[model samples]
Target chain A: MAGITIESITKSFAGVTAVDNVSLTIEDGEFMVLLGPSGCGKTTLLRLIAGFDLPDSGRIAIGDRDVTDSPPGRRDIAMVFQSYALFPHLRVSDNIAFGLRMHHVGKDEVTSRVREAAELMGIEALLNRYPTQLSGGQRQRVAVARALVMRPSVILMDEPLSNLDALLRLQMRAELKHLLQDIKTTTVYVTHDQVEALSMGDRTAVMRDGAVLQCASPMEVYDRPGDIFVATFIGNPPMNIVRAVARDSVVKVEGVEVALPEASNLPAGTEVSIGIRAENIEVHTEALDGALPATVAVIEPLGSHLLLTLAVGAESIKASVRTDFAVKRGDPLWLELRQGSVRLLGSANQSGPSD
Target chain B: MSAAIRRPRRRATPQRQLAYAAAGLITAFMLFPLYLIAVAALQPRTAVFDYPRALYPSPFSIESMAFFLNATGILPALGRSLVIGVMTVVLALALGCPAGYAVARYRFAGRDLVQLLIVSVRAFPILILAIPLAVTFINWNLYDSVLSVALVHTVMALPLTILLAASVFLRVPSELEEAAMSMGTSRFGAVWRIVLPLSRQGLGAAALFAFVLSWNEVFAAAVLTVRNPTLPAQIVGALGQSPLPFRFAGGLALTLPALVFIFFMRPYLFSAFGQARS
Candidate 1:
């Protein structure tokens, strides 16, 4: 296994930049997930690391060797594509053994390794089947087995679970977590799904518009996002931001005063945005101290919890509450914002709430 | 509820019956000329000249076929045509497959221009090319040779072969080749092991098309060769001089190989044509 170090990589296609100047270090045996929305350059960065594409302006090092100029075949990395691009003409065993054969491994060793990979992936019974004969989940397993059989130092996966159905994606997500842990390969996985990133990655890198927003552990990314984009992009239902003007110790939002963190020293009337996660807001049936009165606009039942869309002044905010709360649309309620849960953004680039 | 559970038996509507009748008429119309040729080839020479031209063989005889086979230089011409057809298919595929793969897989300057050139080559009459080519060959000392005729046939077959083979290669997913390369195979090795095998059926269809094009062509064959005439050239040269049964026998012989080739390529022809349009 080897760590990959990328330095200030930038790539452009026909005058439009797809990957900007970005640098990252994927440690040895680390399961790093590059998480972002579509067109965020996560997949392009993975392809760059895999040597399928070259960065126009920077360097890439796998282990201690600089492989920025090397071809994909000499990079000693295997990739599981989003399409599970198995050779249609080859059976499962042959597909698994193809890399070993290309490396000129002995015939007996290739067969044994293929069988071992197949067994490792629980696809031993499917060794003789062609790709067309396998189900979607089975084909996914075969693709993973094909990558694993090569035993490359790094394994790159580009949305490998996106093609599976929701249930199968959940099951395979857990299985892949365990599998990668057992194998202990330096794996770089790219996905737009935050749930998968948080559940599987030892470290998650959030990206936007061809730039890395934050690279940290999943919990830190969720709790202490580095920027407004990372704050809104990481959570379910996303974080809600209300534009406010900061005073010494409190911020004014639609004539209501909310306490700011103690270290906040912004000038009075400075433009700022206050972010609060949906789950962090407490709903009260009766009016309470320091609670803002709001009207419930919509109620969504989610079996275990209820999502309430509240019209607070002119802005609508979502709050997750216990399902037992018998709140209907147009019901008057008071919402309490939890202390230390609010993330204040004073940067000019921070904007209003995102849907 | 019980009636809903049981499926209704379908009866052919008048529109469907009319469609069937129309299709049957078209099939019969297409097969009639083949039947007439077979009948004339099987009949005696005297019977072929009878009133209304025997739609059915009155007296079956192999005398006309025997005469055609025994004619001086006729068998050698037939052998020459077979060799030319086989060589044309081989050469066209060998040259056209790579060109087709490049056109299909790569983006380069003048790629569209190259395809336009290939397509436009078919716009001009082959006789125009063959006449100039005949002069060039005579100057190069290649006149009246089977190789000259085969080379001309390859020129006639190459454009369509490249187009068809390009479509064939386009049907193989490029990601499979990328996967192969990522798994330690070089670009060429990936194409050889993955793309080639996946595209075997389509290439076979392209080869069959080249064979049929070479087999049925006559203008270039006649213009390119004189002493070493191909079968079509020999038959055309014998037209109006040979007896009716002998001409019909030659026609039937020329059509036979194409039919057999199509028969062998029946399964792949469907998908080949389907992908070509795409």
Candidate 2:
């Protein structure tokens, strides 16, 4: 119901900056996922928006009202904690109704709302049981139900599915996506899982070292990551970057030349790196034109596909090929880079291309 | 064929037998005094003072209990002890719960120093505080009052109660309270609704401990009051002069409440001792 605007937010703890000068805007009814590894300040940014931790210098606005100095209770927002954080002593119905009761809603309304939320979560049978009696997935539902009953403008979730086992996490993840889409509430979700971010988020904000590296649609982030870190962090087995020198439309990698996109406009003799996703390289058994010859170092079977680690000169790159393809370690294999799959970066240390 | 292939039941090994013997000896050593108290309380007045001591209850009579209840002022003293014990527990918990919650949840300037001060109070003997407290009570016209004795007992029990309650509060995750706050309840309401309920067993344990401390304290009650004596004060006052039957009956009276209390508090006590299944 409300969009959140964070302007120049900076927070520090014990003189170490946890969230640097960062700004982001979450549009109304958008599912914005803050994704990164641990210690990347994603959680800190969520906490700041939730009014749990005040930023050192910044302004936070929900809708049109500035909530930068308000307490969490005054923010008209609800949060589903990573731990589920259900009251152990309260039954599931009472847990879901807690927010309404706190706001002094009428008795009949509280009961009806509790019932409605329970039904929404498909947990009507669990209404009388305490949190300790519920499994991890059930507890997660109760947590979401509790947040939903609040009917807040925004819901903040911090890795709510992380505690569930693999199958349960997957099921809950799909269910959560459907629930959020049905509610259409402005939600901020934090997670370290790339697949979760890609599948669930309307837009994913990738963060690193207390700064936002890229904030874009999931595919855009996956296909055109803003930097070396974002490129490496967003994909499984990660994007492979090889040191190269660019001259005209061609880049030479360890004496092997690979063609760039037709729009290549970099200056001649420019030092660059070429990033290729594991799925973007084709493996050929025989030497082919415009292909780089390499020796397979390792092959990891992953059910439907095989991940081949190849030694190209001094660098190692991975390629995902069909499982039926005959491949083995120490075999001579030629790899051809697919067009439009390569991203050119100027320097390994630089965040993005100079252009 | 399956039965023939089945494993035999193992017998207790030598080490296990020796462990059982050692445990039995220690149990008997601990129970011997309690047995002697029971025997002495049940014996006739004449048999109580016999040289070898009456090892068994013979010619059992309630005469000692009857005489102690009627001849001495023990009945009123028993009532006074119960009142003081209840008052001490109420006061300790009323003051200790919030202090404990504050210490457990908040980080403030001098928090460590405050904790240290509370813990340091336990290093000194209660007698050291009782004499000074008695002098202060006399000056303030609180002398010879049950309230004065209860106040002293509260001091004796408060430090341990605070430390124990703090640990209990620590076990209830702070995230639950934060989640409640985000759901629109204020911090105080969150604590009242969530934290207190989770810590109920711990607080019960603390209250029971305070009650026991007040019920069994003799020195402070003896020093602080003359007219409204607690059971322990009365027992200590008549210790040497009273006959063996009266003394034994007094000891039983002083101990019976604590034993009954522990029996009733077994469930909460298990959780207080960190034995609850999460």
* Best TM-score among the predictions, by candidate number: 1
- Top of the candidates by DockQ: 1
Candidate 1: regions farther than 4 A off? A348-355, B1-20, B275-278
Cα error, residue A253 of model 1, in Å, equals 2.7
Each candidate: what lDDT? 0.87, 0.88
lDDT of 2: 0.88
In terms of docking quality, model 1 is: acceptable
Worst 10 residues of 2 chain A by lDDT: A346-355
**Clashing residue pairs found in predicted model 2:** none
In candidate 2, what are the lDDT values of residues B1-278, reduced to their tens digit? 00122345778999979999999999999778877887888778888878887778887887887888885678999999999999999999988988998999888999999999998887888788888888999999999998998888888899989998899999988898888888888889888998888888888899889999999888889888888889888888988898878988777777778989988976677778887434
Model 2 C-alpha lDDT per residue in residues A175-279, reported as the tens digit of each score = 999999999999999999999999999999999878998999999999887778888888898889888888888888877788877546777777887898989
TM-score of chain A of 1: 0.96
Interface C-alpha RMSD per candidate, 1 decimal: 7.2, 7.9
